[model samples]
Target chain A: MTARLGPLFEACGAQHRAALIGYLPAGYPTVDGSRALLQAMLDGGCDLVEVGVPYSDPVLDGPTIQAAAEAALRGGVRLRDVLSVVESIAAAGGRAVVMTYWNPVHRYGVDAFARDLAAAGGLGVITPDLIPDEAQDWLIAAQKHDLDRIFLVAPSSTDQRLASTAAATCGFLYASSLMGVTGARDVVSSTAAELVGRAREYAPGLPIGVGLGVRNSAQAAEVASFADAVIVGSAFVTAAGAGTSGVRALAADLATGVRRPAPQPA
Target chain B: MVGIQPVESSTAVPDARGHFGRYGGRFVPEALIKALDQLTEVYTEARSDPEFTARLNGLLADYTGRPSPITEVPRLSEHAGGALIVLKREDLNHTGSHKINNVLGQALLTQRMGKPRVIAETGAGQHGVATATACALLGLQCVVYMGEVDTERQALNVARMRLLGAEVIPVKTGSRTLKDAINEALRDWVTNVDTTHYLLGTVAGPHPFPVMVRDFHRVIGLEARAQMLARYGRLPDAVAACVGGGSNAIGIFHPFIDDPSVRLVGFEAAGDGVDTGRHAATLFAGEPGMLHGALSYLLQDSDGQTIETHSISAGLDYPGVGPEHSWLKDTGRAEYRPITDAQAMDAFQLLSRTEGIIPAIESAHAVAGALTLGAELGPGALLLVNLSGRGDKDVDTAVKWFDLLEDK
Candidate 1:
């Protein structure tokens, strides 16, 4: 069954313009704090929220997200705990997805995982390394749960690969802004616009969300201008930690600037 | 219709999701998350492309020597209480171990991705030599990051890799060994992702890698399966191999994962002893923790920091086993037990004396396990051991262990 995610996006008022996406590491301070942070992000105008399933070794994460995961793990946040929190947030009128590595799902059991995650209020799962050819069983399980299995894209992807990812992914496509690990960058990819433009051809009408190192309003605005959605992960995760209000304010401020029309290159 | 095997479904547990019953997951940074996602996208395309699998199999045959033989060691079997002993001789492969299988596959993938440079970290130098060999053959620039201590101990391997045109960088930070070298390699990979490919040595690390490496090494079990059928007419009673990062053992065990009758046993090094506080028996003594980018059984303390490991063999001196092995042990698909340094040394000497095969210290652990089981199983049962590598590079370590280096 095709996931009817477009309506959800439209219902969230993301149809008319680029959606502002925020990311938070689940159980950063505690489960309760993550819930509050997620709520605050939504209230502050985030159209969608991505919750990171804190894992022990975050190889592609920068210092900020890494520290957040360490804190979450220290707080006894297992994969099940993350799913429970997702259910809680969704119960409280929020739309969220899980961003995690592929192992936790394996450990949690794939078919059971998709069902439990769907039951716990997750709309989709974004597993960065579950190569498409290998995803059939899990995808079938995900489809059984009616959960979206989002795919990612980069400048390195060929046209054929982009098409495969687009065909496999649902909910929205996560387009990496850079090739490196997640962290703030000094400059944007000179090819980010082109990458999104190419992905558009592959997925056609799928909503494209760009992320990885978009730490500020300027960067968010630039990304939003190119794609259907702008995803801010490391920056939001760094700022909106357990007890910090700085992240909330920063996210809100960036939220305003992201919706504003970006300046065209000369 | 695809002729499916019964145990095959169990072996591919995560199916496409990359799970090994809850222990295997991607625990990577968010920045590379997207890149990994992109990689999964490309990998999916490659898997279905017939051309990709054909090319991979072709390389395995033409370059790395596909269908590595299964040798029946009647003399050694008699020594191990007359149990039927068969050696899945990965040691006979071009670079003398199963590590080449994964490197060749990754090097091909790197070329397919249009990457130019290959980076790797080595502790015992087998992986470095294999990667360097693959790079030289493929004409890719190879940089091998090795720990300072390991470089000093395995100096000959450094020379070997350098001769193969790989730049050997001695990492000096942290414990100044394999772990540090891995950290440095990851740093290099992150910084140069556009042009460089990291040829991880084992079936550990983040997602896709364990899956990818295991897929490449499947040839080991695949070949053994057919050869064993031809030689013995049916499946064996058990499969035995040494476990460090668990690549060789996984390579052999993965193909037999669905063969419920094939009892899979992984032998880990016990250094001095498992309980004696000096060992690399991660599965025996380690707690569940994170290291080298995945949550696996690790020789780490309460605070999640890695502990120093001791093994008479430099190759087996690591504080962690591969993540998939951790899952395997937990799920009871494989049983991981310990072999003390003395026992391994004894087995190493015995193999040399009995078969004229001076097995690598790491492979000695498997020899020790086979002997332990062979004595129990008697002459009728069959045990397949992955004779992982040749022992020439480990001569100094063996000489010192046996006190044979008094004057020369």
Candidate 2:
């Protein structure tokens, strides 16, 4: 069961720490900004990152995230640019996972992508759209290249599904904190904690990261209590979408958010 | 685990996971994740509650005129070289299409959720018509986004939607067609997640939709099944329908998925020709990829960008089919074949002349398939085809294609 990403998890675990994960749409404002945002996320508080390879249609994303994707596409950010962004992020001492839809992956050739990501500074690849049953070819290639193939688990997953999904999962398990697309919400669901607990039971020892709709410090702190890592996607995307100063301020704000107590005390 | 007992009817319900044989699951972005989760919860409650089902059934029976009759097309059958042909009359429903079936269910669910408005996208305008009809009945503010090109070609449908009190917004982006309309509608839903519900037309999109739409349309097949038994005293040898995002085909095919004795064939439109780059035959020529939020077979370029697709029939001119349809094709549970514009036109004319029944250009694809398959099956075989919609809106196009304007 020992693998490449396992070492990073072990290192973080030994430090008695949690990872602050960030997500940014690749090439949102500009190519340079995309690379700079990755470095900023890591320098501020992010321990690991998810880089979105923008596609024409981003179905699961909320308005803020969708705007970021559209902006990235308009700026001529293709999947190839994402690889270069990962390479630069790695050079600057950051670890990232290319989070993309299956279209770009298929277009680039899965084997070639797996090899390139492994060579770049990427540790894993998470496809939110590909089910475990349909991920065999890519998973095999990812494993061959020593890259973790991460999968998304929702609260709606059945027991039979939970087992099969956990078996094939690598890296930290991604637990969608809510049921809908990515955006800030009024409050996090109480069931999210229970779902994460069930997922942790299924994939024992693997770190569980919760993402989607984790916006401010209060939400982040609450998620941090239950998760090994708290991933803020739309928040980062929304921040990076603003000018460079906004991105930095938002990243710092998120760091502060995660360190604060839960909005509603336990 | 070897011999699992069937769940008791008292306890049995649609899986909480929203799967129909492992094909439907939420595979989407984080932003709308909670919204869909909420929808799933609401839908689950609605599916199990007799009050919901009873009300929906009442709408279908009284308002939509459902349990829509099955007519034995003997004359049409004799023309198909003597194969016994049965037509399920979904075209008789309000709004003149099977699209009403799915919309009615979603509308009821929307009302249950206390949504004040409904949003939808349309291609050939059948879905827009149905959605508009539902909104009018429910008094929900209806807004339909249609591509500019479609609005021009389908002017009457646009007017019909307006008459039904829907605000038809002309989308002018990308290629200005169905795909762009969908993109705009999705953007709308993300922004207005609280007050609005997107009434997806077909058995496609992300998870819950394909499962939900298919469930609502399952009544079509269920009623047809009993009717066939009563009429023929035995099961049909094969079933056929056209595939445009594959909702109508799936509606009729789902109940029979486990029946190995029956063969299901879906026909896609190959405009001009399949090799001419002017066709919408996704299953025939497309590769597996993600589009409009679902992992399915999509007509796209090597760069993963969407490619332009064409079909004489506007409804079948989409670049992607439903994800379940792609899965079914891959698993060989259903076979997909292509029909050209000329052949469909021939079938369109034949059905109208023979039976005094005009069919939608999209449904004409299936009528063309029936002609070929019926001839091959000879005199004794039973074949059921879902006449999904009426061709009134398509009459102008049909007239132009046949050059009947000069004769008239």
Candidate 3:
């Protein structure tokens, strides 16, 4: 079954636009501060909010997100705090999901983490480092709890891997725009559209979310022109340093970018 | 996911997907799966290919000064209750450590993959030097990531790597040690997978790394076992080595795994003490957790955050041990113990004065443990220890620690 995300993407598809997805660390800056910032993002028209759990060794993240996460961890951000943030997002009438490396959830007991996340009003989890091959227990848990299992596909992924990943994923397939860690680049990856096309060819029914290096509205528009979802992470995390209004402002700008009509195929 | 048999034995460990009883498996990003698969395939094919084996064996003989001899430390053995203490002299290798064994093999693999650039992460700089050495010999571009703290702690080895034409990038993230360096190297691999091959130094990391690295260094055990049999007419009662990411220890332990009569002992670094919350003794005190692309024993907090680790020896100052080591510990096939800095230092000094051979601080941890094991085993019991690296790069730290360099 698809994530409750179907309606969100359906609404965007009706507008001939891509859904805007925003990412924020659950306890960044401060616990309550993150909730307020996510609230602002939702208010600013983000269709979906990804509540990131800060980890000690975030090998997948870029400098901005890594530094922010280190600060949050130093401030004693816990998993419960992440749940509380997701709860706040749900309480504020917003769609939410939790994204983190696999260890914390595995250490907490996979089934228990899934149950708690479901209870906390989170729809699913995005495990950047967890592929479908090594996600046996997590997959079982996500299924038992009716939670969406979102997996990523990279440009380097073989057709076999793309097909398998698309088959395993329930939510939108997270297509890494480039062969790099999480960070914003000067331009949206030139290979993103091509990768998204491959993903569409493989999945067919699944929505594709292009992420990594989509910082500004123009970049978002570029991604939205081809994919079903425009995912922005480092940009929002960097903007959070400027405070909630800044986050909301950027979210609104990005929200507008996703609604831009796709350029007619030549 | 493909199952790999540990070399020289029918041992069925780390089933496909690389799980050694839930300890070793790939826990990395999907972005790296293809490269890892490609590496696994190349390494798998290279193992049985006559030409590949001949090339690697040839380098080991000529380039790395292969079949590193076993030295009987008679004078030092007296301090250990007169036990027959034999040391496999990996320290005499060209790069001064057993790290060259795996580095050379992987460097060959890089050539096979047609990847011109090689990236590595180092703790004590032994592995960095070895990687750089192999890169130089093969004319490959090399970049080494070392913790900022270690570049100063191991300044001489840093210079050696530079002299070999390897770019050294000092990582300043997370505890600023080996763990962070690995993270940085993994990031670099993700960014440049097509152009670069991450020459993982130790037996840790994702899948094939643990088994592949173990296979490359398996020669240590294979050779030492034969030496023990030919010279002493029997296998030693025990084999001992320092456990950091467990490459050296596993190198000397693999062939002996099925030898029920022989004991396999690993000494993990205990900085101040295990109870002091500052030690790098993962097998001694850590719980099972995922770190650096594999499920293994790691020093992590209640929330599953990797605990910052410390050790007087930079090489042993890691929060995680190799997954196979974790499997060995769990299966009761091997035993691991904590060795404190003070004890390791005492052993370091003892080896220097008595045997006229100074060991790398990492190897000294094993020496310290060996003394205790020797005393327990008593006289006449044979103990084979892996003297993993030489002390040349550590002389500065030694002078400062022992106050050997006076104003004169």
Candidate 4:
């Protein structure tokens, strides 16, 4: 089983920057091509990698990710194949985790999936659909397998909800600044800084990462100014259309964005 | 292994956490939880309020046409080997289907929630039209997401929705089917939840939805049971309905679950056949998996991806069913069987010819099942089938299938 992701976040803290996290679907474009994409994210300076397990019905995702997932499914990606990508991500020295909707993992046997993910050296899982309210089976399995169970909080979260959600999370908290699905937007919402501020009150010790529309470096810098980590998803998927080099180049740019100094308050 | 036995208990299921014996729960993104909790809270309060109950019952009685008649099919009984066949005529309801019952209740809930707009996803467009009907009467803006393929197949319904002042968006993603439409609707809900009420169209979906939608449609079984007792003096030998998302099936089946003498049979749509891997017979062939916010029997590939489903009846072309149906199947309280397109179409034609009742293809699946079941039960057995909808919305598809329209 792989250890928790605590040390990696601590290292990023010491470096005085929000960690650069990049996301890509496993078995997208093609089986081998996806492996190249993961390597590119790490090579291009992503501090951590979130390998998405493409699901058939992704309600929380927009068109781009859904198209990529559909293509991945057409290419016959399986749960076992996804684990191999996670294994490669860990072996390449980048922090590794998986992002998937809950059903596939539950169908694979919750305990068995956690055990397998740990064996693959993946640190944790980001479940978009499996909220803390209905995570009893998952919580037990995660504990037994020594895996982190990261939960998400949106801008819509109430204070009580924020506290409860933060209390249940094991690794860093994933805070989607927007209430909408994943996609590249023209401008980032300003609500994220406030959401992160509330989360900081509820979970001061845990690192908080923001996602759900971090497309370019400017948006990345804006988010990183307050957040502990900057997570990019659908934008990276769009870049992968130009192949692995496109992904590497974008990852490098976002990494630089995370390192850029915050604009001072007036 | 724990020895499997039929759990003969109360039909009152989907407890507070919305679990129908581990089959139903809130499997949704965090952003939707607050709204779900609020819905649960509001629905619970409404249920206990006399004014709310009275007003909704009043709408069901007057506007939606409640206590739909029990029509006997004497000529149709000949095909069932002289066995008696009667129907709960939900086909006679306002908007021509049982779908009106749930939509009216949800539309009322939407008004209560102070949401000015409603969004829904539909397959055959029965629920979409029904939602549009309710929204028009109640003065709420309506938008329905339908699969691109279904919108083309059931074009009249799209026109009907548009005429009723609802915007119909054709979803072009994920095999262009009902499940894809649901995904699109959820995305809309995630983004515009504050101003919009989802008004989910079936007995399937996350937490309170399976329970809430079922309660709304429970009137079908409740009234049918009473009507049968008052008119016929006995319960049915068997009660049958088609299972799509299992809304209409569970609606009628729920009232009869405690009656052990009554056999509950839900017929699923088997397009070519279940063996052909082109069918929507989830309980017959699928494994336990979560899809569309509930853990139920879903037709999925080995890797747990939902597979595309095929059925002559667009209403029954869904990969997943209500979670309560999963519990009923697991507990042996109800049995599900598959009826192929040919059998359903044959029954559809027979009912039209023999009884002058043009049933929906979805309901035709149930009629086909009743014919086989009546033969097995023999001469004196009483069978009650819930004719879920009228065939008006299906005329175009039927015209193509039967080649009735002339090219002259």
TM-score of each predicted structure versus truth? 0.68, 0.73, 0.98, 0.97
Candidate 1's displacement at residue B131, Å, is: 1.8
Candidate 1 lDDT by residue in tens digits, A75-118: 87767778878888789888889987665675566798898888
Q: Candidate 3, residues B227-251: lDDT per residue as tens digits?
A: 9999999999999999999999999
| Residue-level lDDT tens digits of model 1 in B213-262 | 77777778877887888889988888999998899898889888888999
lDDT of 2: 0.80
Compose the digit string of candidate 4's lDDT tens values, residues B148-187: 9999988988999999999999999988989999999999
lDDT tens per residue, model 3, A1-266: 55767788788888889999999898889999999999899899799999998998898888988998899999999998999899878887899989899898888899999999999889999889999998999899999998888899999999899999999998889999999999889987778888988888889889999999988888888888999999999999989988999999999999888888447345
Predictions ranked by lDDT, top down? Answer: 3, 4, 2, 1
Each candidate's chain A: what TM-score? 0.94, 0.93, 0.97, 0.97
Which parts of model 4 are misplaced by more than 4 Å? Answer: A1-3, A264-266, B1-9
Looking at candidate 4 chain B, the ten consecutive residues that score lowest on lDDT are B1-10
What value does the lDDT take at residue A137 in candidate 4?
84
Worst 10 residues of 4 chain A by lDDT: A1-10
DockQ scores for all the models shown? 0.09, 0.20, 0.86, 0.86
**Interface RMSD list for the candidates:** 6.1, 4.6, 0.6, 0.7
